[model samples]
Target: MPFASQPVRRVAAAEGIRASGHWPHTIPAVRQLLTDGLDLDPGVTFLVGENGAGKSTLVEAIAIAFGMSPEGGSTGARLTTRESESPLSRDLTLTRGAGSARWGFFLRAETMHGYYTYLEQNPGMRPDPQFHELSHGEGFLELLRSRFDSPGLYCLDEPESALSFSSSLALVGVLNELTAGGAQVLCATHSPVVCSLPGAAILEVGEWGIRRTTWEDLELVQNWKAYLQTPERYLRHVL
Candidate 1:
């Protein structure tokens, strides 16, 4: 059945993050991180930032408030959370445009060995060749190719966790095709290729908060590419 047509959900987070003070009290660069909420089209929206910039905090709050799970992580393990049975459940004064929204996550699965034990719980539901049964990169692609569905919002945190260069490009193509068909995708990633999914809106989290940036302007991508293309100049001094 086709999903019900609903008013697209709007996340209006300009700054000021708190969970009644459950999370780390001091969120660095809070204002600079999300000075304005990006209007996520009915397509891919990529969140890019350095470590400890509060990107995950924003997404985790949304997931919790909506009673949805962040895609990755194990059942027993813990992410920063308040005392709650479902970490993905919370009460926030959200100013939403209006709509029925659901959330899921696309965290990179752990190492192959860990993934095997993880998958052992889902014998029937596991992907072919199995997630644990394939190389880290292949397993990730297969899981995405098989499991990701449409007409819902999905959050992926740094999916470049396992992909090689070739697979990374392929993953980009897949994200493009998914959002073009009317689904909403919100991803937190450092991969330039993953972040540049054509129509994706790039949000950079820094000392202030979250600001919209063009795909070409991200310094990490530029520098990383430069290093990869010519390593000797950068590496010669270190060695």
Candidate 2:
């Protein structure tokens, strides 16, 4: 049977996020990625692109508009309002059928500290004493394992940042289980492991615009995969 695209159940933000005159505003031309009149595929949608490709930016804007915080989206990060002044704006009157009955996880890099505090604040949470309390990568995986359980919409930015070869596979396993059980997962990543979900749709956000492609078509993932798959060849070329 042929595959069908996941229909966007709901879209939280249709435009770019708001920014003050300084920090958020000075970064780049974000408001230009306004995703008006667009919809996400229903089950699992992957935002595949490079760091500054604006994939995360657009996701962050919609997430914030959906009541999430900024890109460093930690609860500790001061929750702010939309970018009413910024040229980029999200205009979404979510259809009750899609976004109304949903739970979500929006995990970004800069705001990981908020999640750290979240775990620490729990009654059972404990403060870490080791310099390697968890390797930076380990901590990132731990966050994924700990936070991603309930059924809802989840958007992740570079979840591969924390995983080793083995751990990346483990994270992929978690995502597979989650999607198999009916949760919606969206991730922006360089790890082929995480993007290996059986039926994931990859949207490549680039200088031009969004393009749907296969996971292997992603340069970062393919390059890394090639290096890992044939280290001696890469090593020989390197020397």
Candidate 3:
């Protein structure tokens, strides 16, 4: 479990985007992130944002820049369908720590089915029970147990998309273990459960750009708290 104190220290957008005329510039959040470099925690860094806030865009770009597949899998798993990745990976610079990662995976909830198919086709790469054969949440847990056995970097996008509340809590536990084992995790999520991991660095993304914040300060967390406190108050309108 012993590893370097930090794997990836920071990620910064290189200058010359204006001249490069890349598509990332078109997205306001991306432009803002490019302007202000992002500092990563050695353990866990959670990227929290509303839809279209560019969290996924930034996470995917980081995964690609770190040499992982865009479709979401291990670096060895070269799975791709169509090229929808932004050029941001090519422009961004990743600063590593004293040591390099020995293992890593990029898990995008939306494309996990594709990753499972790839694994099924390649039995050697497939874990026991087969990823596709298991339920969505089960597959994610299995990946965490098996693929994340070593100290490495992990990038995840909305991993709680298919998970229930209990399952999200289970993931939080797994993440706690992973970080304790010296893994660095970058997750883009809307799940309050996933964001509530103690001591995790939370970066809130919005039209105003990204800023370091706490779980209590996040609008998503605040709304969830209010709704949970008085579901009747909000549900009355919807119902």
Candidate 4:
């Protein structure tokens, strides 16, 4: 993969918005991040947060701001199945490093089924073996291997939704290769496996606001570690 254009360097909400009634403004993480802005890692930037922490909202906004479909697929992918996207994209400002991104894709776990269906209906867009034919994890991997061959920006939301532990590890490799090939990846995920990429920037979203953090410091990783160390402690209570 060669550089078609420079990757996105930063993303922030445009200044001077009335925050009284906005949906994003009401979300603590979104509000703080929008005001403070985020400087992305040229290689990889991972967004880690608990459920309802606005991770998906932020990632979706970035994808839309970059002109990718609010659903899933590359900028050229025009398959629109619904109009459920938030209005945050309209208020975002993206700063480019030097060149422009020639290729980009937005991959969201929830809407992948619909995206695959769209491809099936449009034969020209359908890949070999058809995306729907494969298992969820397999289909996602195939898409990454085949469609993500070029260097560009990729925004993914909860990509681990369907991936098994092994598949998530494989994704780590795919993402590592993409970054090394001049691509930039911004992902929102809960899987420790996916977020374990070496040298990547990890940002934790919470009530305190978006700030730089380490993989070890992430609450998700901490909880996972605790569980792995003693599953019976949690299972005892839940079961």
Structural similarity to truth (TM-score) of each candidate: 0.72, 0.69, 0.90, 0.92
Report the poorest 10 consecutive residues by lDDT, candidate 1: 80-89
Q: Estimate the Cα RMSD of every predicted model relative to the unseen true structure.
A: 5.5, 6.3, 2.9, 2.9
Predicted structure 3, TM vs. truth: 0.90
Q: Residues 16-93, candidate 2: write the lDDT tens digits.
A: 433445433333334232333345666677887777776666666555554555543332334333333222324443
In order, the Cα lDDT scores of the candidates are 0.59, 0.60, 0.84, 0.85
Best by TM-score: 4
Which candidate order results from sorting by TM-score in descending order?
A: 4, 3, 1, 2
| lDDT: worst 10-residue window of model 2 | 1-10
lDDT tens readout by residue for model 4, 1-239: 23324578777777775444568778877787677777777788999998888889999998988889899888888878779998988887888766656689999999999888877776564445578889998999988887777778899999999999999999999999988889999999999999999999998888877878999898999999999999999998989
Q: Candidate 2: where are CA atoms >4 Å away?
A: 1-36, 71-100, 122-132, 225-239
Give one digit per residue, the lDDT tens place, for model 1 in 1-239. Answer: 12333223555432454333333324543332233333444567777788887666655555444445343433222243333332322333334334544434435333334444545555544344555557777878877776565555565667788899888898888788777665567777878878877767787876756667888898778888889999998999899
